[model samples]
Target: MDDVAGIFARESPYLERYVQLGIASGRVLSVSFPDAPDEDAEVDHELLDRIFDYLSGVEDDFSDVEIALTVPTDQRRALDRVREIPYGDQINVETLARMTSGIDHTDEDDLNTVRTALDQNPAPLLIPDHRVRDGPSAAPPAIEQKLRSLEGL
Candidate 1:
């Protein structure tokens, strides 16, 4: 298994905040809110810039940034649909469950699958899990709301 062997931190567009990324094999594996910047960690300048851009309301949907996720097949399917949600747009959980799981109607089990997939999203901003209305993400509520506000949602 690949471990998060690289760490990078940068000043976030969010006031008085810094964002840290855990990277491995040239793909970002996680994002976190840290109180201070790390000057010693290796830097992936390009990816950090993209994250800053996204936080700055630059309107890039993060399609260019690569993220690594390990999840069950059902969860992967739901996340794939979540990734396609554009910046500043939102989708209801019911609709997303149908679109991703291919259920003819809104089923509780399917909705739970989508919810669980979102709740377990390893990378939030890169995957845009918050774009799904009432969607749960690993990101803190403040951060998710901040991201949504940044996107003008």
Candidate 2:
């Protein structure tokens, strides 16, 4: 099983990208996003346990699946907030490195720092990007041909 475990915040967006790439490559088996509530708020152990129970339900399907977590660079406060939680300990640098690798055209120094941090602490943090990419259009001629055919019909 190539599954990765990380905080929900860090893993969500990267999961989206990984799923997209998996769909493109036809290698994705399944994806998991374990829910984590705000830690600074009052703790509801029962609710948290229930969430874990739900995650356990799907654990079998992803027996051999690769797990990835999304870590946001902007949520330092959130990371600090969850430091006491059990899953919080699982947050590490490898997950962050994987997430960083997904980012397009990042500076080498920044990437290296993130890698080094992962090496040192081995925790994942979430980094969200509001920027959008305007990727190239797919199947342009096919789309045009379909439009022309409809007009002719």
Candidate 3:
């Protein structure tokens, strides 16, 4: 665990752990809660401030934060719906499936599709995968729950 403990670690005074972010081409590619703080993120200074604001419990408009995702149309649709979820509000997997696929009721296939999309999400917080209850995300489950608790409308 010591060797690769901080592949995605970012130093923050607000918390004991790290909040690492990956950025490229004016878009955040990834965010992760690694076990420790290691390398410093090198990206836009503005985005760094925004991330710090978020870490400090400020409900900044993450909707405007740019993110990159190269996925199929269906996955993009699911991620788009995830972005629309209210800051503090949470939706169920079944509901997300319905919202994305427009099925009368949610089935395993629809739910799985949504799950796959969420799991494949390159950008979690910007896309707000934590806003979806039981939704899969690249962020750790603990971090997802913590984000849900911290963010408010």
Candidate number with greatest TM-score: 1
Better of 2 and 3 by lDDT: 3
C-alpha lDDT (0 to 100) for residue 67 of candidate 2: 22
Candidate 3 Cα misplacement greater than 4 A, ranges: 1-9, 13-15, 36-40, 101-105
Candidate models: Cα lDDT each: 0.77, 0.27, 0.70
Sorted on TM-score, best first, the list reads 1, 3, 2
Every model's TM-score: 0.85, 0.20, 0.78
Tell me how candidate 2 scores on lDDT. Answer: 0.27
Cα error of candidate 2 at position 45, Å: 1.1
Q: Which candidate comes out best when scored by lDDT?
A: 1
Better of 1 and 3 by lDDT: 1
Candidate 3: tens digits of C-alpha lDDT, residues 1-153: 112211234566554456766666656667766676444644335655687788777776577776667887777888988888876688888788778755433477767778888988887778888888787876777777677778752
lDDT of 1: 0.77
The residue-by-residue lDDT of candidate 2 on 9-117, one tens digit each, is 2222312211111111222222222344333322222222332343333111122222222345522322222232232123333334334434322455554554433
For residue 58, model 2's alpha carbon misses the true position, in angstroms, by: 4.8
Write one digit per residue (lDDT tens) for candidate 1, span 1-153: 144467888776584567778888778778776677666666556777887876666778777667777888888888888889988899988878777756433578778888888888888888888898787877878888888878778
Q: By TM-score, how accurate is candidate 2?
A: 0.20
Q: Could you tell me which 10 consecutive residues in candidate 2 have the lowest summed lDDT? A: 128-137
